[model samples]
Structures are given as C-alpha cells and as structure tokens.
Target: MEWTAAPARLATASADFEADFAACLHWSAETDAAIEQRVADILADVQARGDAAVLEYTERFDGLPADSVAALELSQAELKAAFDALPPAQRDALQAAAHRVRKYHEAQKKASGESWSYRDEDGTLLGQKVTPLDRVGIYVPGGKAAYPSSVLMNAIPAHVAGVQDIVMVVPTPRGEKNPLVLAAAYVAGVSRAFTLGGAQAVAALAYGTATVPKVDKITGPGNAYVASAKKRVFGTVGIDMIAGPSEILVLADGTTPPDWVAMDLFSQAEHDELAQSILLCPDAAYIDAVQREIDRLLPTMPRAEIIAKSLSGRGALILTRDMEEACAISNRIAPEHLEVSSRDPHRWEPLLRHAGAIFLGAYTSESLGDYCAGPNHVLPTSGTARFSSPLGVYDFQKRSSLIEVSEQGAQTLGAIASVLAHGEGLQAHARAAEMRLKG
Candidate 1:
C-alpha cells in the first residue's frame, strides 16, 4: 500500500461538517452480544466456583495450567527479585517514574483528600470525613505487552490515599511472566498479585474467591471482555470506568514541525486499529506537510501496520477556517488528549476547555503524560472527557458527613424535624425527634 495515501479529509467550512465530524467521533463502548454473553458466563462461573472457575478460565483462555490459583500468585520476594534482576538502566527508569508518580499523587492528596470539619453558629459540628478504601485491585494488561507504567499509575494513587491492601492482577498467558510488571508491583507496594486476566479476574476481585480477596474497588483499562466484565460487576463492586478506545486530537497553528505532529498522531494510532488521531489546522499547506511526514516516518515504526490501519480507518486531517474554529470543534469532540501545537499555547488553552489532558506548546507530546508527566495517564477516553476527569487520589477515597448536634442544636433541629414529620403524617418519626427534646 502507498504510504502517502491520505486519511479522511474534512473542512470545517463544509455544509455537512457537523455530521461528518460526528461520524468521526462515533464509537460505541457497548460490547457485541457474543463477548457480553461470554463475559457474563465467566463472571457467573467464577462467582459460583471461586478459584476452580478462575483456574479453568485461565487455562482455557491463556493456555496456562495451575494446580491452584494460589500457585499463580507471586509472592513479595518474587516481586522484589524481579526488580532486583532488571538491568541497571531499566531499574533506574522504573524507580524514576515511580518516584515522580508518587510525588504527584502525594500533592493531590494534600489538595483534595484531607478530612475537615467546622462548628456552626448553633454549636453543631458538621463536615466531611475522608477515608481511603480498605483495598483496591489494579489490572495491568499483560501477555503480549507489559505495561509497568500502568502498575505505577493505578497502584501508586491508591497507596498515596493510604489503601492498606493493593492487589495486582495481570494475565501471564502460558505462564510467561513480565519481570517489569512484577518489579512495579514490588515498587508500588502491592500486597498481593495473581497471574490472571479477563472477566474471570474481575469476577475474582469483585466477589472474593478462596485465593483472591475481594477489593473495595477495581481500577484499570482492558480489552473488550475486560471492559464488559468491569461494567457487569460495577454494582457488586465499584469500578473506575468502562473506557473506550484511545484517542488523540492535535490543534496546530502551523508553528510546530509537521513531522512532530505526524508522529504524535502515530503515537495514539499505534495503540489499536480503532484508536482515533486527528489534526485540525487552518493551514492546508501545513496539513499536507504532516501527511507527507506521516507517509515518510510511518515505515520506520515497528507497529506500522497498526498505525496505518488506525490512521486510514479513523484518523483525519481536518482544515478549519481559523484557530478559533479549531478550538470550537475540539470542545465538541472532547478528545482524550488535546495538543495545542502552537507558539502561544496558553492563549488557545482558555478557549479549549474539554479534554482529558492538554499537551501544550511545540515540545509537549502526549507520550510524556503517559509515562512520567507528574499527572495521571489514566484519563477519560472517548467523549467521556466532557464530563469526567483523570484518575487520581480522590478515586481511591470516600467521604462521610460528620454531624455532632449539641443539646441546644438538637432542640432546634428536633422541632423542625417534628413539624416536617407530622406534616408528612408519620407519627413515629415525629415521636422519635420529640424524644430528643427536654421538657
């Protein structure tokens, strides 16, 4: 296939621009019937048979046999051994990334995770009490790829929030383990870990098996089956999100190098065939330059096939009337990662309000945010950025309202409650409040 072949082209000046843009943004997170049914059966089977079912699914799906699910669990000593055995360079990189992630989350905890209470004029104390979850499960995609970064992202935040038991789960297909993942677990302070994946792993986490203890919440991204499983087990246990495919949109003002922008698009495109990558610029000439750069540099990428399929399938090179129009369209798209590759990024940043993470200026690439940018890489994907936020310490904490009514205050509140309860014709409720009153 010719590398210079263009991606879908769109002009904001067109009469049917809205419809076209909507088409590009459309992606249904709903899993297909077969995957949903399979996930349902797996979740139910694991719930019923516990460790035996997990073992069965792990063997059948991952082609790994374990006498017991407990045998699949990696001990802390093994995790630390993996960390110790990594080459010096890899060890330093992992430690550096973890340190930065931990520092960022510690700051996040100070900003939003503290408990506070205040006494009112009536001498009644009221405020929110912040508490960390007892336990959490971090799912890292394993087998073909090892994302040590994901281990740091999910586990470190919960650790910062003071979660005592952080259980890590990864699919080690055919008993092939990634040392980096285990190393991350050791560094991030995971209390337990198991070699498991898919709906069965999620089910094991949601409903405690004999081997895997149930967690207060589950947080991480996964394949379609994992996504479906997360959604199914939501009410039974809290979940982070049913995340859609990855996406990135760049708003260029013809200042940054076309090669840089082209590579940025390739970054998200290489994630999967359905991942979306688009560039919106007023300069048609610059857009053409980026297209050429895409053609030239794409052949060099190891995942060229995935990048090509992603670009041709869902990517676009859009022309807008001006930067203002570009920002307007970007808000509508509410992309996962929005890069303002311009001279004065801040000037456009105020106008660009909706994105999971904004990469500013000519130098900032979305890849930095994914690794060690001090901010969370676990962002809201698809248009969920319009309403949601990046995963943080807050996601691992819960709040409770504290109320200590003084004697005088109770008298005042009791009369109000009695009146309302009597008005609602609930005599028992009125009497209960009246009992608190003296004389």
Candidate 2:
C-alpha cells in the first residue's frame, strides 16, 4: 500500500493535496442520468402491468422465483417459527438491540397540540397539529447478506411515530425469507412482511398492487437500482435520502492505537469498493503505525481482498497541522461516520458540525451505531449530511398549521390581507377575506 504524508499546511505544500480533494468530490452527472432512465422504465412497466411486471422483474434481478403475490406475504405462523428457531443467545442480542432502538425513537415521536389564541388588535387562534401517516413501507435488504438491524432502524421509528400500518418488504433469495429477518420484522411491530424486493418492490409500495397496499412513504437502503426506483417514484410516494457508499472518517491523535484505527477503517471498506475510509491525524508517526497496522490486519480479515482494494483505492491517511485542521477536513468530507479518537473528544465535539453520527473516544466504534446503539444507522451519505439528517421518528409524521380567526380578529387583519391580495392581482383572495370581515 502506498502512503503519502500530507504536509502540515496545504498552503505551503505542493498541489497534490488539492488534486486529491477534488477527485474525492467527483460527482458524475452522466451516471446519475443513466440510472434515472433505467428507474423510469421500470416504474412505467410496473404501473402498466401491476403484479405481473413486479414478478417478472423480481425473478430477473433478485435471483428469486417469481412466486404468487399471496405467497409473498409472511404468515403469523412463519413469524412465530422464526422466533422459535433462533438460539437463546442470538435472540437475546436481537431483543437488546431492538430495545435500545425503540427507546431512542419513542422519545422522538411528535406530540399533538391544542389551538392557542393571540391578540391581533382583537383575537385569533393559531397552532400546529401533528398527525402520523396512515401506512408506511420499509425495505429491508435480504438474500445472502441479511440486515436485521435495518429492520429495527426503519420500522421502530415508524411504529414510534404512531403510524397505523407498517408493511415491510425484503428480497427472499429463491423465494425464501431469512429466519432472522422474519424475527426482526415481528419484533419491530411490522403489521405486514412481504418476500419481495428490488425496484419492483418499490413500485408496488408506491403504486398499490392487489396484494400490497400503497404506502405514504418508503424508507431503507438498497442496491443502486432500488435507489433509482425510489428517486423515480418520489412524488408518487415519499422516500428517504438516496444513500451512497458507506464512509468513515477517523480523527485521531497520537493517543489512539493503530490496530483499532486500522480495523475501524476496514469495517467500512468491506461494505463496498467505493466506500471511503479516511484517517486524519496530527502525528506523522501515528500515521505510519496505522498504515503498517493496516498491512498486518488485512490478511486476517474475512473480506481481506475487498478491504485491500478499497483501502488502496479510496482510503487515505492525511497528516494535518493540528487538531483544528483535522476537524476542518472532517467537516469538508461530511462522512457518514465520524470518530473522534483524540485524548479529549468532548473538547473537539464543538468543532464537528457536519457528521451523520459522531463517535466519541477510543471505546466508541462505528459498528455500535450500526447495530446496538440507539441512534439510527440509516444516515445521509455522499456529503449529504451537510443538508440532510439521519432517519428518525419525524420522517413518518406530518404536521399541519392550525388557524382559527374570531370575527373581530378577521376584521382587524382584513385590511392588510386585502392590500396584499390587491397588489398581487388576487381579486378572489381579497373578496374571501372581505366577506369574512363583513360577516
């Protein structure tokens, strides 16, 4: 592996650092457009043919049999069997993770409000009302790689938000649902679980099929095709952010261990080749040790080939002037996972303004937030944390502004409304206010 030591200050250094930073932000407009076209084609087919189109696409893409729509739905007996099939230890761990996730999301539920009156030369009542979505669809990736954690993260929040119905869809490999995924769906309080996935599943959720009910929103991570489908069906049904490859930025000082840093970097790299694992440190010797540790640890990992390719291709060990510069680089990257492994993480916490999730101290690992930690692992990726947010209970709820004007209040505010409406050439709007004022 090649190790390039970044100078203390890029202002005084060569042009290499600027070049590498620009390469990191290489957004491909062409690639986005191509993916969008494919998604649009899939959506149009599904809309025209309904379940028949969904079945054909599932077989072609997911390597699963195009079974009957009725067979796709999981029965109560199957859910019970999933819970019974697990060993006591695994079951306990899943339950514990579910508890923490539920506790965190439950606290995020928006509460209903009553109308409040304010004096407007007279009196007027105004407030906001919070209501939960009627139904929601959560996509959980299945097959060889089962993400039971995703089931907990997506479903628990909708449940906490008091959504009336929750439908979960997962790709069953060769038409078989993983027992662990089934158990997670049950534990997370999902009203329905379907063995369907890919772009077809997204389409079914967006435009209701005979078997699957249309949902108010869909939330979860999937492959590129699934993401594109969600983007295409956005106006038809709400969607979570378009997540990209996972990323982890570790801001460490000389106090941290090289092995811990190397392993954490590998954790994200194994997710995908495009996944970025970057380390920014003030100490040059620490960077050297981490690079060496990565070499030693790569062979021991199960996904060593993947880790090696990702680290060598997308990973970097950037040496900064000080902790301030290190934090500045982290903000620029806006990584999905940010780890502050310095001596005093609390002091550096104030400097970190743009990360999906922040891990403090050497003890906190990004893996914890992915599974057991209370925070949602479904975070904004690809530098989107600058504007978007992590998934939460608020994603499943809608709010409406409530307004109630008394007769005297309408009379007092009518003149201003009339003036604005007249200025804008909205004669009907002025007349409505005038009628209320006169009444």
- How accurate locally, in lDDT, is each candidate? 0.93, 0.84
Per-residue C-alpha lDDT of model 2 across residues 286-384, encoded as one tens digit per residue: 888988788777777877777777776677788788899889988988889999997899999999999999999998989999999898999998889
The prediction achieving the highest TM-score against the true structure is: 1
User: Against the correct fold, how does model 1 do in TM-score?
Assistant: 0.97
Say which candidate scores most in lDDT.
1
- Over the stretch 187-252, how does candidate 1's per-residue lDDT look in tens digits? 989999999998899999999999999999999989999999999999988998878889999999
The regions of model 1 sitting more than 4 angstroms off are 1-5
Which residue pairs in candidate 2 have backbone atoms (N, alpha carbon, C) closer than 3 angstroms, thus clashing?
none
**Lowest summed-lDDT stretch of 10 residues in model 2?**
3-12
Distance (Å) between predicted and true CA of 175, model 2? Answer: 2.7
TM per candidate comes to 0.97, 0.93
